[model samples]
Target: MDIDKIRNSAGSMKIADLKEGDQITGMVTVGEDLYMIANNSVHQIKLADSIDPKRIDPTVPNLQQKIFGKGSDSILVSRTMIFAHEICKGDVFEDSFNKEKIMNISIDLLRCVIDMDECFNIIKLYNKDAMSSVDDRRSVDLSMKLPSLGEKAINGETFFRKLSMSYLLILRTFWAAHNKEVDKIFDRTLDFVSKNYRDDERFIKFIQQLVEFSRMFKDWRNLIEHPKRGEYFKIIDYTYAGNNKISRPMFEVVSKKYPQEPVDLEVNMEKLIDLTISNYESLLCFLCERKLKEIAGYTFKVMEIPLKMRRYPHVRYGIALPTTKGPAPLG
Candidate 1:
């Protein structure tokens, strides 16, 4: 409730101090329970089972309230932390370096999602209320210009690129553990997977889907990073084509894979976000299934926060073993 926000040389901050676009560092284990540590202090993390709004102190900022209160898309944030924990199990990364790499990547991925989700929410909110004012329906210029594409903007194209880069980096690191030659480049990684992991049909299919998914955003991602002539994000403003229609604010990015077709930035971004999350879930399940015998005695537990207060990640999970004996079955 009265979570102290302390700034340190390492730039670590607690989950309570987490703003809409703030990035999480890494989580730590304090005894058997999990706590997110800042520079010198550890914040008590509320699992879904323990998250109660009524008990929330008024000292918590409104930003965190939106994130950790009700209807916050924070479950994904929690899932990312849990994902890192679970991913580190069962011989994925043999060394501490790779495991720490996984942790860093997962934390950054969580931040990317936090920024992306908030940007998407803003765009959706503006569009939903666009009809409220005539000017609202008019095209709005994002703060970013073509010359410097790196300037932070609360838009789909920017955050989408962020998410893609992080995902690809994680994929490379993840696969490299299995095959040391895998590179961070997406195409090269795909080539490696295609040739080496071809025996596994599910993995191959996933890689294929991932390739296609990456391609969907490839042109725009590249354009943002390395723009070519005549390639630009059509700002969510007036629909210049139709008969003077006030269009819903959205970005229009042409796919190099589908140059002739028109793509809705918002719609595609939503789909991409869902696909990204599912891909992670699939990867985790794939690994667990691959070692069923080793993990047979463990149970995956998801402690979910109430749906209303799920904005900031409240879910905590782990592969748990039964520690208490139940009554023997009566015969």
Candidate 2:
């Protein structure tokens, strides 16, 4: 594989190869174990300890030359959690922290809502075609297999799962931004909320709710991302006309706060989706509002999501430059 060529040309790509017999071999030798694609999709082959370290980064510092850094696993990252539209308000701006991190998270929360809406639209087909009439001759309540809708449902699940996971990631990012710490997300988030936003009990509860939701779904998010065999159960709704069985992956989530009833998620995807969306929107709105208020002496403007405007609606903000006449818009 031309790794540098692929990295320079494309971010990622999907490969569609033959079904039965396809072999992939490479002459590139390395020191570490290599995991490569082969013919079988169900099984995998690992060539371990078969390469020389000269093929990899082999810079070794002595024991006394440690410095501050410990170790690093060079991983390929595809996308960031958030990217906010950068805008300058004044010459004095935050040089340390990512200035627009909170707003980027807010935008991602909006994305969560938008993606949930799309997922719901896709899943609606299952309910819509659950009963179909056949040319005025016969009417069947359901079919043994609805390939198209099932496929669409699976795609919808993929979208919902990813977008929801992104929201969870940003939820943790908000904690990192607030608490100035990177580990123990739930604890750090709760500490930040208690120390900073505890003046309003309602707001504190809402923040806590958002944190708890993300923490609960952390493992569930992983399960959805990398699904494994025999890790889930199939749920058959006999109440329906046909034997409609939805093979939902089951995973246990350990919650530090709520430890009462472990509700089965086999039939509660919609409810979980709704909860995630609600928590995301609520928490992001609160954070965005706080961020707006944090700005000083900069009478800027921002268009909130529930915005009603004519064509080309935008958030216009500016920093007034010092001028002889008065104050002018800064470049």
* Highest lDDT against the true fold, candidate: 1
Per-residue alpha-carbon lDDT of model 1 for 1-331, expressed as tens digits?
3332211113432356544654444455422334553332224454322333453444432221222221223456545645555444544222422444455556556666666677677666655654444442234653211111122234756676766765674465445345344544668767876887778977888877776666656665777677667666454553434554444545666544534245555676677676676676555445443433333454433232233433234332233333354211111
Worst 10 residues of 1 by lDDT: 143-152
C-alpha positional error of residue 230 in candidate 1 after TM-score superposition, expressed in Å = 4.3
Q: Candidate 2 at residue 283, lDDT?
A: 51
Backbone clash pairs for candidate 2 read 30-51, 30-52, 31-51, 31-52
lDDT of 2 by residue, 143-262 (tens): 443223434545444554654566566665565344354677677777877887867899878767777666545544554555455342122221223344433222243333332233
User: Candidate 1: what lDDT?
Assistant: 0.50
Q: Which portions of model 2 miss their true places by more than 4 Å?
A: 1-97, 102-118, 133-153, 156-160, 176-181, 222-278, 292-331
Off by over 4 Å in 1: 1-73, 87-98, 135-154, 176-184, 240-246, 258-260, 291-331
lDDT of prediction 2: 0.40
The whole-model lDDT of each prediction reads 0.50, 0.40
